[model samples]
Target: MTQTILYARVSTSEQDLSHQRTQAEKAGFVIDKVVADHGVSGVSTRLAERTEGKRLFDMLRRGDTLVVRWVDRLGRNYDDVTDTIRTFINRGVIIRTVINDMTFDGATKDPVQKAVRDALIAFMAATAQAQAEAVKEAQRAGIEANKGDVTKYRGKKPSYSRDQFQTVIDLLSNGAGASAIAKETGLTRQTILRIRDDQPAAETALVKWGM
Candidate 1:
């Protein structure tokens, strides 16, 4: 039987995965399993290198269907996203996105169809990568624009709420390591370190960005 699998990636646990699962269900997919990588940045981590992501690759078989929230869930880089898609397709696994119900398959025998499929894959991958870069650029611009108003500006709103940040601080106060805090709170290890090192600055960014 051709099993259905859902792959989800989130940089923080604060970000909900249930939404993605709900989306897949709404799209009429019967997911046999769900594999997710939490607190891992999509822009920096390749899908194959992620703990749960690697397992997904191994669990998938020919004729199985893999669903994701979007192309970016597979990867945030152009080359990585496209290459990962190609790998799954080559394995006879059908890739589908919940965001658009888009499907990519390599089972087509026609040369023209294959070319069109390949072209679409490249275009989507590039677009996903561009979007990720655009977000980073926007954040940089926001910070640069506010450098002069440090006193008035609190910083971008953090991804974690005030209470959540307090929890991080409390953990750090106990001499907990970054990795430990990350595992406990679903925040990235880098985030934990940032909170531990310069909490005021991190809090300011959180307030400014309203993250």
Candidate 2:
């Protein structure tokens, strides 16, 4: 009745899937199944909107447990984050985060216990939102700082092949939208558009750097 299901997410396709997978594995979870959402920015609080997110609803069950590397993986918005966790609780699912070793459940019958549980959920959700906002603000500042000068190097390496780039182009040329390409190729829309714009330099960088 109690088992672990893994969830991993990345803001961009260039991020390596193996990294998250390793984290979950190292945390002592064999990962009976994995739900991965790619190219969905953490700044967005709607976990359900992520491509692989909906799959979680289908794969997880009442008695099963949900596992993530961190609480932020559940959501970025405070209300929605708390609601999502509590929803799973109502359905008899236990939510566990590897980073903090936290657990949330709906097994208590006492009112005070319920109040404590809800309070904890609210606090975790608010902290997740604050963390998300902080990351977003930092990214915006970095972009603004680099807006006038293309002098510094971005630590992230690009990832894509010429053939891969052409695939995106062809998909677009055939009238496929960004979302469609993302679903089909497991590449993010931002990645697809970059290829569509014919950035040969970017394409090469994608190959050389493996974004």
Candidate 3:
């Protein structure tokens, strides 16, 4: 029997894997196994270099099917995503995305079909990369904007709730490094650092905004 495996990756712990799994299930995937990497930035780490991602590469058989919520979950760069999909396809694995039910199979010998398939893969990978960068840039911008205006900012609605923010503060109080706290809470390193360095200000803003 051909196995159906779901590979989910999130840069922060705040991101939920259940949502991705739900997306896959809604798209009619019967996942036999799930492999995930948490609190690992996709932009900085290649899927092949991740702990669970490495295991995914080793465990997937030739006839196995791989499912992902989107191409971005597989990688953050266009070349990396394209190359990773190609490598899996070359091994007779079917790669499918839940978002569009996009399928990539490298089983065709026809030159025209191969070209079309390759082009689509490249486009999708590039799109995914662009979206990831956009989100990061937006986050950076939001942080910068909030830095100058305490009363007007209120911390851009926060990525985590008050309780979650409190957890970050507690970790910092315990002398945890920003990176360590980020890994522990599934938050971005920037977020961890900001809360760590300015917990008092953040707490004030949270209370003021009732966040």
**TM-scores across all candidates?**
0.72, 0.68, 0.70
C-alpha lDDT of candidate 3 relative to the true structure: 0.76
lDDT of 3 by residue, 147-194 (tens): 878655554566765556745754564567988988977899998878
The 10-residue segment with the lowest total lDDT in model 3: 202-211
How badly does each model clash, as a count of residue pairs?
17, 6, 1
- Estimate, for each residue in 16-74, the C-alpha lDDT of model 2 and write its tens digit: 66656665676576777788887786666378877888677767788898987667788
**Superior by lDDT: candidate 1 or candidate 3:** 1
Put the candidates in lDDT order, highest first: 1, 3, 2
Best by lDDT: 1
What RMSD, rounded to one decimal, does every model reach?
12.3, 13.4, 12.2
Give each model's whole-structure lDDT: 0.78, 0.69, 0.76
Cα miss at 56, model 2 (Å)?
A: 1.1
Candidate 1 per-residue lDDT, tens place, 110-129, comes to 99999999998899899888
Over 4 Å off, model 3 = 148-211
**Leading candidate by TM-score:** 1
